[model samples]
Target: MPSEAKSWRWRYRFDGKEKMMSLGEYPKVGLKEARDRLAEARKLWSGGIDPLAERKAVVEAKEAEEREQQRRAESSFELIARDWWARWKEGKSRRHADTVMSRLEADVFARYGHRTRHLRTSSVKLNGS
Candidate 1:
């Protein structure tokens, strides 16, 4: 026997077109919750807002925020500089690479290691200007 699948859904018209939105599934969203969701959708529709579009906007905003956070985390100056050095140091002498890293640690990393590399202004000031 094929198991029956059940879900809660609501149908409504928006901009003269019919649309359906899923509230949730059986046992998870109960009858009361489904009715509440339907009422909320109806209220939004009456106010000229498309419930589906609103839901999509919220989802997109959340995804964009997550991407921005990940980009910031990956673009820190120390992370980017280390990645560059790993690739650039191939075939270079160990002493030369160590000297370069020592200078970076003493100078650049000390000042901007935790900062993201996409800053618009240089963090270091030249001649106190």
Candidate 2:
């Protein structure tokens, strides 16, 4: 153990190479947890799984999950509807697009507000112009 002014870490030799792993900070980790981590790393070595590789795999999986959740949130109805209108309005004159949007707001969106909670939860279909 190096007496440097940094967090306590575990180091060991494996396959003729020296490896280092953080057991966490000194006061927070304590001696017991560091020992536990050392034993765990040894167990990983015996099982033929490199501790560093295992940690990398776990981090990748967590990041992938977060990305998937964010994609779903971005695809929600309110956002998609606004995007669709923005694109569809581009080919039409401003006055015509505004007229069509106002009609939709008055006829379609207005109905949703007065609907019963149960009715609002059901599928809403818009007629194609």
Candidate 3:
């Protein structure tokens, strides 16, 4: 059998419908803090804003930011170049592909592999240009 857990929650009506929102867990959120949270939610409701919707929007924005950071990390120059090589090597001679990859590792990747795909050309300073 699982032990029961205690949590603080607030129940209120919005848009002619009943809704409940979790404030926090017991012990972690004391009585005073729970009441404070309830008051904040009520204040928002009185101001014609749905506290639940506002909280959901904030959570979604944070999630979106996290996903964007992950995307940028996955799109580094070395990763993109390796992905391209996998497709470009098909039907090509092993020696030719190996030579191409060796040159890229020793030259391009050494200098700019850590950069993300969103980098602009002007941001990179060429040796000759």
Candidate 4:
């Protein structure tokens, strides 16, 4: 991202034709959003599409996907928990599975004396049994 002459330029090229596209002036866009936009534009070019128009479409589509994911995250806690439990059940003993279920029900949500969710899902609910 280049700021020059009171306008912001996102520089790029394709087919040996170098160019700088105006991405509006500063205070109108942030550096992170601009970089993300550039990445999507390049992805479209690699897939054989025009970059400029595809950049707009990609932003809109990406926003929609993000919104949808946020909505699902807000609405589907139980479903997500069940999905997690199903996966956890895949490689653990019955005793371990029981310990995990107990922890979840107890809201401990962690391995014994551990606070992170990075524990092995298999036998996550470990039991001496």
Off by over 4 Å in 2: 1-5, 82-129
Q: Write the per-residue lDDT of candidate 2 for residues 6-52, one digit (tens) a residue.
A: 56676766777888888778788888988898788779978887786
Encode model 4's per-residue lDDT on 19-121: one tens digit a residue: 6776666567777777776777678778877687666687999999999777665445454565688898988898988787777767633323322333355
lDDT of 3 at 76: 90
Better of 3 and 4 by TM-score: 3
Best by lDDT: 3
Pairs in clash, predicted candidate 2: none
Off by over 4 Å in 1: 88-114, 124-129
Rank by lDDT (best first): 3, 1, 2, 4
lDDT of 1 by residue, 104-129 (tens): 98988877787788764544454321
Residue 124 of model 1, lDDT score: 46
Q: Could you tell me the TM-score of candidate 4?
A: 0.33
lDDT for predicted candidate 1 compared with the true structure: 0.88
lDDT tens digits by residue: candidate 3, 15-107: 999999999999999999999999998899999999999999999999999998888879999999999999999999999999999999999
Angstrom error of the Cα, residue 31, model 2: value is 2.5
**Residue pairs of candidate 1 with colliding backbone atoms:** none
